[model samples]
Target: MLAFSKLTKSQASYLFSFGIVFIIYLISYIISPFTSNDTPFYTLIGRSILQDHVLPYKYIFDHKPFFSFVLYGVWDALMPIKTGMFTLLALCCAAGAATVASSIWKTNRFLVFFILITTGAAFKMLSGNTGVLQIFFQILVLYLLQYPSFLRIILSGVITAFAVNINYLTAECLSLPIIFLLYHNKKIIFNIFFFIFGVFSGLFILFSPYLYSDPLALIEYFQQQKQFLAAYSPSFTTRLFTVIKLFCYVLFFIPVLYVWVQQNIFQKQERIDPNSILLGLWFVSGLIASCISGYPFEYYYILWFFPITIMIAQIIKKPEKNFKWFFMPIAILTLFSVVDSTINNIIKYRNIHAIDYVKMASLTKGGSVLNIRALQTHFYMADLKNFDPYLFKEHIDIAFGSRAAAHYMHDLEQKPLSVLLPYQGCEIGAVEATVCHYLHENYQKIYEVKIVKLSGKIDHFSFELYKRKSGA
Candidate 1:
């Protein structure tokens, strides 16, 4: 009921900026090209939660923290939409963009442009990776830290703890940047003390469910997670890509240094450069995380988005006026790339249906459904149980993957009711002789679908749905 005329310029500007950010992200999600295998992988955990009325820590298989799975569970209960994840993703990115817009300008054009460019990359490659969300939280903390207030510091600490629960690698790399931030506080001791205290406070919230269920179960979960990631360190090719991406990210900072020097040296101004140093640390942390990631996939680039965009904001005096013509071509090119990706996704992102198999699964209660490399999105949609609780099935199938997978597949005496093989990437069934032999002996192929994805040429995939014999 409030009138617009009654509002101040700041309020109106804030709302306008929020609207712009929201629309950009909304468009990004609407035109998104692909859904990650990760989407349904996490969805399976949510289904487990709904059935069990508690987190399924008993399935000591996956490495990710338990917090995200709980939120996914709550989301499905309320929204119950397949693409609901898109909304969650867009909202987080929008919030971060809005924060930058509020400080930088009405548009913060460069920041928005950066997000659109990289967001397309994310949808194409890192769609369901947690790195994007982690950057969102990191930006939020970055903004809050600008004020250096006691309350803000504590809140930053709490949010950071939550961020770590999302992805241990990216957040851990931020340690030096955080230390740099703490050094700038007026009362360093008090802020550091409270920050650590707030971190423990956040940790309590993260661990409460496990503490309530069974204390030792938490330790067991940690062991299982470690057993899985123990062999996940980067390979030679991964490390090479990490170096290349790091070099590319460093190029973005030249403008930041240009701005920093212009303001401090040329203008003959004397001021602390803590923000610059912190921003540099932010970039370094991302490089470190990428190096540590067993595979420096495209998604890892998401971490660099935070520091780079923030640095751009600091560099441009008037984003719209400064960026008017120079960035116009870049903007067009970025959008074109994204649009091309969208078109490619529409044509190439194949969804090999398994309706008949899911329906058959429904008929048989207390039956396990095995999904090979293809994530079992359908099983979760039907609220069915997974044969293997380790939802990140690809990692389990890879070279030097978790030993638990070896033990789990050691005996195939009791085969699953339904098995899905998308016969595409990795084809672990072709590599693992024991598993291949077991499938050959017990399961029979009942349904097959051949789908063609054409980016440049036709890439055909044959999906085979298998069912065990009546009394196999």
Candidate 2:
């Protein structure tokens, strides 16, 4: 306690902020460690990359760029598979808390407290996706650019490059340098040169494996990425509705918009704060980036959490009399939403717990298992290996069409072990037509159990395990 007393106020504030954030993350991890499919998928890829010492896409399949896997790879290297993800989660929250605390520690103490708590709650909803690292690096880049220096500007570019590699959706943040370049008056030319140089250097380092090991592979990767996007791109109506639906999730920003109207219009301030402009730009860019995919996954909204939190903090620091009425109710509602979502996620993932790994392992005899629209955690827990390249089932039919389905059927012919399928109303006929046909002909259903689903038409669905028939 004497050592604690010796620390400065800012230092104490940072520790307190970190403690709150880390504890929130810890509780979320304990109740629902794997909140979404993304957690197990990314963690499994990370584990494979660390153990095999090669990029994992060649073995497993994922369209996410390389750096997120690299971060996970490093995390998985230091700890065992089951718990390594929690350590990463803890570290990410710690890093995010430090970033938040460092940026606002000297400002209004209440604002600092508010941002830290909200950011912690927001991070809990990330569910260990690449968005976790991607958003962190993007926020760090913005923080660095918030006060540009010779080194800080260059570092910002490099960090943004890392963010882009972690998740290509972060490319929207690349425009942020333009905002800084306009505001920065000193050594503009040198800043431009340095930023570009840093970006190139970061890219070179990230792609070095393909650069040196197999140059042709880089070209192939881009081609594959292009084809993948083209295959899955939704129509205009889908994208439009998606944008409208997601916008409702961010109504807390109405207060920020209200503040902006007051400052720019009602009061007619001679000069607007550049930092306000910067924050607004970053928030809008994140929204645009998320909209580009057209898949209405709620996890994508994780990008909005930090910027919105900071904007609200700015409001609270010097709130207007009328702004309080708007902000307080919205803040309360947002808090309720965060708590409600966390509870729902915990309940949703608890359903995945119905998969009994001991029975699965016994049924498969520790052999390769083909999982179709099933939880990936089963493979990770059972230490099972997959012989086929089509490890990922999503978009396989859309992206690769008949050929991919044919290949999956061909793998079923080998029939190394059990086949796991989502039990849709106990009628295998209703599932993917081609695969359903093959499974019925070749495999015999051994077990089926009810699995709860939170966000679908039915509250419960069945999960089934199938073993290959003898002499067939």
Candidate 3:
């Protein structure tokens, strides 16, 4: 321990980075047992790869690129889907945080604190979003920007390509400003060649088995992305809030801008780091992409926050002692906001607790289940398509809220086995209502099953098993 403490700054930094990463891993593992809709979806996809070698497109409904499938590789190696995904998420978050910490350490300590606070809040708020992997790749790009060695350039290009795979939005967020800067600096020839090589390599990996079979499929995949963007819209209130939210997001960069302006006004040729430029571009590009994307979710905006935090830290080298007073309130508010939002979401979507219902449903062996207000059960069944072949083979049927069932079932291949349960009084036009309507239509065919009490007072729980009559 004495010898370790006496190590050089570089050695100490490396150890600190490793320690922080380990802590993140521990936190993620602790939270893994409690599941969510998004997590199970990733798990199900990972499990599918282990069971079936094919990449799903039409069946899964998510247009995520091949980088996400890298998680599948990790899952395959790790064995359990939840453990693999959480582990990967934890590692990515750590790597991203470390990149920021290391980049800013030489520049400013106060900026580092702000970066830590904002990043911590962002991580906690968007815990299960899987956007962290893309953010990590973005940070890597920033880290590589100043190096400019052949190796670093190649690696940065590869990281940028990988970012596209996780979410095309990442590419959209990081690409324009990077290209613009490259062009303005008259590095177009190099940029074009590098970009082409990266794109080709990325496509080769993305479409390995099917590249020769049908290249049009990859083109169609991108075309669908455009359609998705076109179709998205924000609610009226959300639209108004989006503008205010963007202003708040911009505050993360104020320090950096202040420093840049001050230096320019004084004619001081402050040696501009290439990494700082890359981070500025990343933040600017991401902000523009989020704005144009129209139906902006808070998680989508988070990809920009990390890079901006790093930039701000770089700008404010040694803040005044009194500066802490102002920073403390902002940090506290950010923490409280994230915590409050997370708790409210958990309460609203307690579907994470519905894992018990999933286990119960799995035990029933593909039988029709009368789910009360549990629409997540159907999504879980969809996700478990990789796990339970019997259910996949038999088509696990569900009858829930009218809107949910109608929405989910419209795309389902088979008609529901039976819809006998009635919508409870608290629910409006719910599964119970749908079941009541079904019962009214086919009175002689269906029978009711046991009703159970659930956690919430307003939502009474029940399960009814239904079998189709042979003649009908």
Query: What TM-scores do the predictions have?
Result: 0.78, 0.82, 0.69
- Where's the lowest-lDDT run of ten residues in candidate 1? 346-355
Q: Compared with the true structure, what per-residue lDDT tens digits does model 1 show for residues 1-472? A: 4688897999899768655654554454444322554555665575566757556556424567776666556555665455536445545564565466346323365555445344435334235456666676776666666667878888888888888877787465677778877877678898788788778888888788779978887788787777666666557887787688656645544545455445533555576466656667777787677667756465666665555555555556534334445444434434554565544444423442423546545544577767665545545545556666644546555424545345446534557787766653225343365665677678777766555544442233345667787778
| Top TM-score hit | 2
**True-structure lDDT of candidate 2:** 0.65
Q: Assess the local accuracy of residue 117 in candidate 3 as a C-alpha lDDT between 0 and 100.
A: 37
lDDT of residue 337 for candidate 3: 50
lDDT of each: 0.59, 0.65, 0.50
Off by over 4 Å in 1: 1-34, 54-57, 100-128, 148-151, 249-267, 272-277, 314-316, 319-333, 348-366, 376-378, 381-383, 399-411, 424-434, 455-462
lDDT of 2 by residue, 157-276 (tens): 788788888888888654753556435547777777777877888888888888888888788778777788788788898888779866776665676777855753356577776656
Top candidate by lDDT: 2
Per-residue accuracy of model 3 over 136-179 as CA lDDT, tens digit each: 66666655544344566566677777777777787778786557
Clashing pairs for predicted structure model 3, backbone only: 111-313, 400-431, 401-430, 401-431, 402-430, 422-432, 423-432, 423-433
